[model samples]
Target: MAVLKLSGTLNSEPQGKSHPEAGSDSSLSFLHGTKLAYASNLVRDWHADLLHYQGLKPGSAKLHRDNLLRLLNHARVAPWELQKDHVTRYFESRVNQETGQMLAPATVGTYCAAWRGFQNYMLTAERVNELFSEFNVRPKAFVDDDNSIAVKRHKLNWVPKGWALTDLEIDAIDETFRSEIARAAREHSKSLLPLLRDRVMFHVGIHFALRISELTELRVSSFCASLDADLQHFGKWGVLTVTGKGDVTGSVPMRDPSVHGLIEWYTNSVRQKILLRRKSKTEDDGRREIKGQMVSVSDLMFPSERGGVVCPNGFRKRLADIAMKSGVLRRKLTPHTLRHTGCTLMVPLYSPEIAQKYMRHKHLHTTLYYYHPTPLGAANEVNSAAQLFDDEEED
Candidate 1:
C-alpha cells in the first residue's frame, strides 16, 4: 500500500468554529508541505462534489471531513493503506472521551457511513488500484446486514434506567422549572429571563422531541404561526420546520397547547428582556461576534446573554443543574433524556407510527427500538390474555 508520510498534528481546535475570512485557505497547520496541500485539495474537492451532486449542506459535508480526518490521524497511514479491519478497529475504540462509555451504535454507524463516502470518493478519483481494491475496504463489513450495529430489544419487564425518563418525572421537572420562574419573577431576580428561557427550552425539547443541536439552532422564523393572527389569539396549531440529521428538513406540527403558550410567553415577554439586556452591552465588549459576523436577536430563538446563539454545552449544564435541583439527580438528565421520554410516552398513547413521526425518525424500526413496551404495558397484555382464556373456557 502506498503510504503518504504527512507531517503535522490534526487540527485539535473545536469543531464547527468558522474561519476568520471568507474563502481563505486555512491549510491544516499540523500538516507539512505537499502532503498538506494534497490532503486539503482532496477534502475541498470532495466537499464541493457533495454539495453540487448530493445537495449536501456545508455543515453535513464538514462532518464527513472531520470523520475522515479522525481516521487519518488515528491510522497514520495513507488512504490507500486503510483496510476494512482498520476501519472496524477505529470504531471499536470510540468511547466517550469524558465518560469512558461506549458510544451508541447509531453514532458508530454514522462514522461507518462517512468512511464509506470517502472510499467511494477515492474510487471515483481513480486512486484505487490492485493494491487498494474497493472490495478489500468495503464499509459494509464494519456493520451488520441492516447497516447498523445490532442493538437488542429491551426485556419485556424492563423499565427506564437512566436511558430515558418517565412521564411523571417529566411532569416533575416541568413543575420545578415553572415554580422557579415564578419565584424569580416575584423577587425581581436577574435570573428571571434565564429561568424563563430554560423553561421554554424544556418545553421545546420534550414536546418536539428535538435534538439539542436542532433545539439550539432554532430561529424565531422557524415557527410558522398563521397570518392575520395575533400572538395571544393564535391557537396551538402551527408547523415547525426542523432541520434534522443528514440535513433533512421536516415539518413537525405543534399540537401541545402548553408548548404554544410557552412560546408565546418567551417571545412576547422573556425574549424581549434578553434582547434588551444584550442591547445594553457595548460594542467594544466583544459580545457581538458569532462565527465571525454580528448576529441579531431576531435571528435566534434562544440567544445567549452575549447576543449570540446559546452554546449547546452550556444549555445542557443548566438543564443538569435544574434536574439536580428538582431532586431527580439519580441519573444524568440530558436533552436526549427528554427526547426519549417523549417518544416512549407517545408509543403508549398513540401507535408506533405516530411515535415515529413525532420523534422525526426516518425509519419506523428506530422508533420501535427505543419505545418498546414497559412493565405496566406487559402486565396489561397479560391480564387481557387471561380474560380471553376465561371467555373461551366459558364458551
Candidate 2:
C-alpha cells in the first residue's frame, strides 16, 4: 500500500532556528517544508517506530509509514516554522482507501494529534488548529443525527461514552448464547460450532474489556497454556500479548471462563480439523492435505473454514450475530460494545481507577466516562417537583 507522497523544497524560514550543529535551515525543510519547531528526537523516534509498527498490519502501516517518512524527510527542521494549515492539509488529503468520501476531520485530527504530539513533545508549543479541524462525518447511506459519529476534541470527553448494556440487555445476551454455545458444542460433538466461538468472544470482549484489535491479534500461541491456569501466577491464562492501536503492547490475562471453554474447544478439537483441512492438497492421488506441512500457531486461533487466519471483519460479524441472535445487546451489537460493557461490569467489581488500569487507558477522565448515568429529563422533573411543592404549600 502506498500513500500519496508529500513533496516540497527546502527553503529557509527567517523565523526558523538552525539545529545547533547544522549549517542553515535552507537545507532542512522537510514534510514538504512542514516540520514544526516543537519536535524533538524522542518524539521523532516514537513517530518513526509507530509508523514501522503499522506495517505489520495489512493496510494501515503503509499510510502511517508514508506519513512517518514524510515527517522524517523533514525531521531536521525546528518545530516553530511548521504551520498548522500545512499540518491540516497533510491530514485532510483525500484517499480512495478508508472510504471513497473525503477523510473525516476526526481522522485528520488523529493525524494532527500525532503531528502535534511530535511538535509539542519537542516543545514547539503549537496546537494543530486554532480549533480542531476534525469532524465526525456521516455517511450518505445515512440518517438524521450522527450518533454513530466520531467527535472533534470539542471537549475533554468529546467521545461521549456509551452506556453499558443494561442489566436486562446483559441477561438477554447471556441467555441467547448459553444455549447457542451448548448447541454448538453438541452439534459438532467432536468440534465446537461457530456459535461457540461467538459466545466465547462475548465473554472475552465484554467481561474482559478487550478492544477487538487486541482480540483479533490473538493467536493460538496467545492461549497455549491450560485454561485452568492460576491467576496469581504471572503469564498464566494463555498470556495473550496484544499490540493495540498506536502499536502499544499490553499483556492481558485471558482469564474469562467463557474464553477458556472456547479456546479449549478450538485447540483440542477445532484446531485438529483446521490443520487437517489446511494440510489437504491434491497429490498424485488427487487429495489436498498438508502431508508435509510446516505449521505454527500463526496458523490460526480461530481460522476460517478454509483454514486461513480469521480477519477482523469476519470476527466482528460473527461476534455481532452472536449478540444479536442471543439478545445481549438490544441494538446491533458491535465488537466495541463489549469493551464498553466490560468497563461497566468492572464498575461494581473494581474502583474506577483499577478499571482504567485494566483497560490500559492513558487518562482517568477517559476511564470515568465509562460509567453511564440514567438520563433524566430536566424540564419535566423540575416542573413536576414545583407543582407538587405548590400543591403541598396551599394545603
Candidate 3:
C-alpha cells in the first residue's frame, strides 16, 4: 500500500493483496484459486488426463489429447458445453468392444477430462483472455452452483500405485529359467554367459528391486564397487543414477554377490569372445558407440545379440520360464515381484521410512504392501514360568 501510495497508483480491490503498508503486482489470473476460480495457467493441458489415456491406448499423451478432441468434434459439443458434467457423460456413453459395456469409471475419468480440456481450448479462445476480466472466471460454475454439485477430479492413473513383486514369486521365476536358458544358449550357438546373464538379471532385480527399465538401463560403471583407480574399484558394488517414471532419477545400490558374479562372468566372456574375433568387429579408431568421459558399457549392461537395448518383454519371458521351474511360486512371477521381495526382506531390518528412501517412494504406504511380519500363533513355553514359580497352597 505504501509503495502504491508513493507511486500515485493505489491498487484497487480484487486485484492486489494488501499487507496494510505494501502490495505486489501479479496477473488477475492469480485470483483464480481465490476470487476468480481457475483463471489462467492453472491448467497443465490436463497432462495427467492425457497420460492416463495413453496408458490404455498406445500413443503419446498428446496424441491421446488429439483423439479426445476428435471425439468431441464428432459429438458437436459446444465450447462452453465442455464442462465436467458433459465430459463425464460423453465418456460414460462410450462402449467397450470386448465386453460391450459402458466405459469403466477409471477410463471415463481420464478420457472425458482429456476431451473436455482440448474442446474448451479450441472452441473458447476468449476464455484464456477473459481470465483478466472480473465478470466471468468461475470454473466451479461448470459443475457447481452452491458448491453442492458432485464432480470428480481428473488425473492420470498410469504407473499404478500397488505393483511390487514378492520374493517367493521372483525366486520361482529365477529357478524356472536356469536349465532352459542354458539349453537355449547351447542351441543358438551363443555363449553360456547368457545363463549367467539371466541369473544376474533375476538376482539384481530381486535383491535391489529395481524397475525393469532401471535394470536394463544399468551400466558397468554402476556395478563398480570403487571409483579410485589406484584403490582397486573393480569387483566392488557401485551406485548409479536411474531415471524412472516422469523422468525422476534415483540412486539405487546393488548388494547381491550373485549379481556381480554373473556380470563378471558375462564381461569376461565378452572380452574372450571379442579376442576370438568371430563377427564384424567395431573399429576402435572410428566413431565408437560410447561417448563422454566415462566409457559407456556398450549402451547397456545387458544388450541383445544385435548389441542393441535388450527387449524388455524378452527378458520377462526368460525370467517367467525361470520362475515356473523354480519352486518358489506355483504361478507365474514377474520382475516386479523381485521388487516386492526386496522390500519384504527389508521389513525386519529397517523402518518403513528407510525402506522408502532406498526404494525412492513418495509414500511409505506403497512400501507397506510388501512388508508382512510373522504372527505369534503359539508360545514356545507351553507351561508358563508362573506355573513353575506358583506358591503351593496348604493342603
Model 2 lowest lDDT segment of ten: 136-145
> Which has the greatest TM-score?
1
lDDT of 2 by residue, 1-395 (tens): 23332222231123454442122222334434223322344344545555564334434433433343344444333343444444433334444445445445455444444454444433422233411222122112111113212233334345664657766776677687776667766666533544555556566677567787666545555543434447534233555655566455655555456556655665676556655655334532322222233444334555545554446687777667666676445566777877887876664455555666677776665655565533453123322222322322110
lDDT of 1: 0.64
Q: After superposition, how far is residue 62 of candidate 3 from its true place, in Å?
A: 2.1
* TM-scores for the candidates: 0.59, 0.53, 0.57
Any runs in candidate 3 off by more than 4 Å, and if so which? 1-82, 96-100, 112-129, 132-137, 141-191, 223-236, 256-299, 370-395
Error of 2 at 126 (Å): 18
Candidate 1 C-alpha lDDT tens digits along 1-395:
11121122132434465752211224445566655665577677777888889887787887777777677666655454566666666655554445566645545556767777877776653544432453354222233433334222212333544366666677788888988888988999987887789888887877777888888867777777644344424443376777777766776666667778778878888787786686444444433444445645566888777677778898898789889988965888988876776665566566566667767677765665565345566446423222322322110
Better of 1 and 3 by lDDT: 1
Q: Identify the runs in model 1 with alpha carbons over 4 angstroms from their true place.
A: 1-51, 55-162, 226-237, 279-295, 348-350, 378-395
Report how far off residue 109 is in candidate 1 (Å).
Answer: 6.3
Better-scoring candidate (TM-score), 2 or 3: 3
Clashes of each: 1, 23, 17
Can you give the lDDT of residue 81 in candidate 2?
43
